[model samples]
Each structure stands twice: as structure tokens, then as C-alpha cells.
Target: MAVKDRDRFSTTTRIRLLGEQTAARVYRSQTRRQARRSRLTSRAALLALVLCTLIVALAYPIRQYVSQRAEMADMVRQKERARQRVEQLRDLKARWQDDAYAEQQIRKRLHYVMPGETGYVVIDPDAARQSRADQGAADRPWYSNVWDGVDKSDASDQ
Candidate 1:
């Protein structure tokens, strides 16, 4: 009757129904947001994997290309050095072809003298002292140093 009608049309009953509908809508929206977040995460992971794969695939070839460029530069430097050396040798050969240069080299190296000329050598005092000091080791052959090393090793083992 009238009481039942009053209960159905009460303000509190209407407020309760509206609140429930709002809560349901909020829940649905939260689930949709979560799904979207998961999809975006998967896409980001796939992109990262693709980038890593590309870096790995190109790594070795890029390294080899850089190393080859450096090697080519080194070879070019060696070629230039060799060309300079050949030029120097050619100039030396030309100098030696002259008779005066040949005589000068013979006089300097072999201490040779012409028939009526005096051949006196002036020695530096400082250089003579250095030679005297080095006579203990520098004047000796390399084999002597090696044999001394062997003797020291034998003495140490004893």
C-alpha cells in the first residue's frame, strides 16, 4: 500500500542505488586501465628486445671496420717511411759515386793520408775518460755478459 510505495520512493533508497552504480563504473574503469598498462609494458619490452638484437648483430662488423681503418692508416705510414728511406739511400749512393766524397770517407774511416800530408787525430779528453770508464763492460763482447749471468744462476742454485 502507501507504505510500500513510500519505501520505494525514499530519498535514502535513491541515494544508495546511485552510489552502487558509481562504484561499479569505477571498478570497470580500473580493470580497463590495468589492461592498457599491461599491453603498453609488453610493447615496450618487445621494442627493447629489438634494439638489443640490432646492436648485437652489427657489433662485430662495426668493430672490424674500425680496426681495418686503423690498420690501413698504419700501413700508409709505413709506406711513407719506406719511401723516405729509399730517397735517403739514393742520396747516399749518389754521394758515394763522387771521387772526393769517396776519398773523404776513406780518410775519416780508415785514417788514410795522402803521400805528403800529416794525418794527426785530435782526441777529446772527456770522450777518452768516458771510454776508459766503459772499458770494464762496454768494451767486452755480449757473450761475456751472458756467460756471467749463467754463472750467477749456478751460484744462486748452490
Candidate 2:
């Protein structure tokens, strides 16, 4: 029994036992470090996923907000254009209210000559190919247009 106890307490046996225990402790510490690293990695991946989801969820509303703002700006511009057009129409209406302006437009557009006033039109060779007789309906006569309309209707029937 003393011999067996001496063998157990021998330097070689003690060194072997200490080495085994140290090896086991080192292995356990490495395993725990790996577990902690894995947990950190998983947490980081979860955080990244959450951030991506939030960005994706907000993307459409953000895009819509920008586009709606642009649409509103376009509408404002259209409204301003419409307002300007209305003002121009109002000014034109005021101009037409004046008897002189109305008379001038009628005379210019219809080529009218009041009573005995002579009206002459210079024919331009480079201008439109209007017929000499149809240069101005007023130049000929009102009855001429009526006759032309009747003639055209009669020709179409044939």
C-alpha cells in the first residue's frame, strides 16, 4: 500500500494529471469564448435585419411624400397659368366692351367699308393661294356668299 501511494504521488503522475486538467480548462474556456462570439454575431445580424426592414417599410411612404410634393408644385404652377389666362381673357373682354375696339376688329376681320368709305386690298403673290374672287367675302357682296352656298349644295347633290 505504501508503494502504491508513492506511485500515485510520483512526479511523473502528478505532471500528467496537471497537464490533463489544464488541457480540460483550456478547452472549456475556448468553448465559452466561441459561444459568446456566436451570440454577438447573432445579435449583430438581428440588428442589421431590423434596420433593413425599417428602411424597406419606410421607403414607399418616403417616395410617395416626395412625389406628392412635386405634384403639388405642378398643380400650383398650373393654377397660376390658369389665373393668368383668366386675367388675359378678362382684359380681352374689357377691350371688346369698347365700341371702337369691336368696330375695328369687325372691320379688320370682315374687311368692311362703312357707307361710302373705299376699301382696297393689295394682293400678295407670295401669300396664300386664295382665289381672286374670294379675296374678301365683303368685297363682293353678302348675296354672293348665299349664292355660292346654294351652288355648292346643288353640286354636292349631283
Candidate 3:
């Protein structure tokens, strides 16, 4: 009977020890899971921080590049306008070189009359006095006054 009692007591002690070991394993597993969760959260936060930093670093240069491109496009448009203006001026210069156009401009500006055409001059006394004064300043040839009169009329017309 004593032997049976002793065996029963040993069995009870073994079962209690096994239960304690199982509880300890459960606690260790829970702590390991909590540690893994915290580690993953920290890694996610670090990834977000790196992404934000990259965005901040690149933003200003990208904006500047876009603005510069727009300015370059505007300059190109101005160059095209200048080129067109040059072409128009070239055409005007060509027209001025034509003999008939040149003669027409001269006749209109100088009020010239052809041979056998009557030419009239309406002189203001004050201007005539000034011209006579200017003529007295030099001992010029007689034809100089006639040429000067023609040039004066052309300049006044313009």
C-alpha cells in the first residue's frame, strides 16, 4: 500500500511540472510575437521617412527645370518674331531700290515739276528772310541756293 501511495505522489509531481513547462513556452511565444510586431512597425516608419526625404530633395530642381523650359520656349518665339520682322524690312528695302518707286518717292517728297510744267512757290516772308541770312554767311556758287531750296522742301515734306 505504501509503494502504491509513493507511486501516486510521484505521478502527481511529474504532471504539475509538465503543466508549468507548457505555460512557460506559451509566455515566451507571446513575447516573441510582440517583439516581431514592434520591429516591423519601426521598419515601416523608417521607409516612410526615407520616401519623404527624397521627395523634398527633388522638388525644387524639378520646378526650376520646368520654369527654365518655359522661358526657353518664350525666347524661341521671340526669335521667330524677330526673324519675320527682318524679312519684312528686307522686302521694304528691295522696293526702295526699284527705279520707279525711288522716282515716285523723290517726286512726292520734293514736289518736282517736269520740263514745260509750271512750278509755283508760295514763300513766307519770315522764312525767306532767314534763308537770305543763311546764304550771306558763305560765298557759295549760284546753283548752291537752288539745291539747298530743293533739299529744304523735301525735308519739310517729310
Candidate 2, overall lDDT?
0.88
In candidate 1, stretches whose alpha carbon ends up further than 4 angstroms from where it belongs are: 1-11, 123-158
TM-score for all predictions? 0.64, 0.63, 0.47
lDDT of 1 by residue, 55-117 (tens): 999999999999999999999999999999999999999999999999998887666889999
RMSD of each: 8.8, 5.6, 11.6
TM-score (C-alpha, index-matched) for candidate 1: 0.64
lDDT of 2 by residue, 49-144 (tens): 999999999999999999999999999999999999999999999999999999998887667879999988776775447674555766654555
lDDT of 3 by residue, 37-118 (tens): 9999999999999999999999999999999999999999999999999999999899999989887876665667678988
Residue 109 Cα positional deviation in candidate 3, in Å, after optimal superposition: 7.1
Against the unseen true structure, what C-alpha lDDT does each candidate score? 0.86, 0.88, 0.82
- Regions of model 2 farther than 4 Å from truth: 1-36, 128-150
Provide the lDDT at 59 for model 2. Answer: 100
Greater lDDT among 2 and 3 belongs to 2
Q: Which window of 10 residues has the lowest lDDT sum in candidate 1?
A: 132-141
The candidate that wins on lDDT is 2
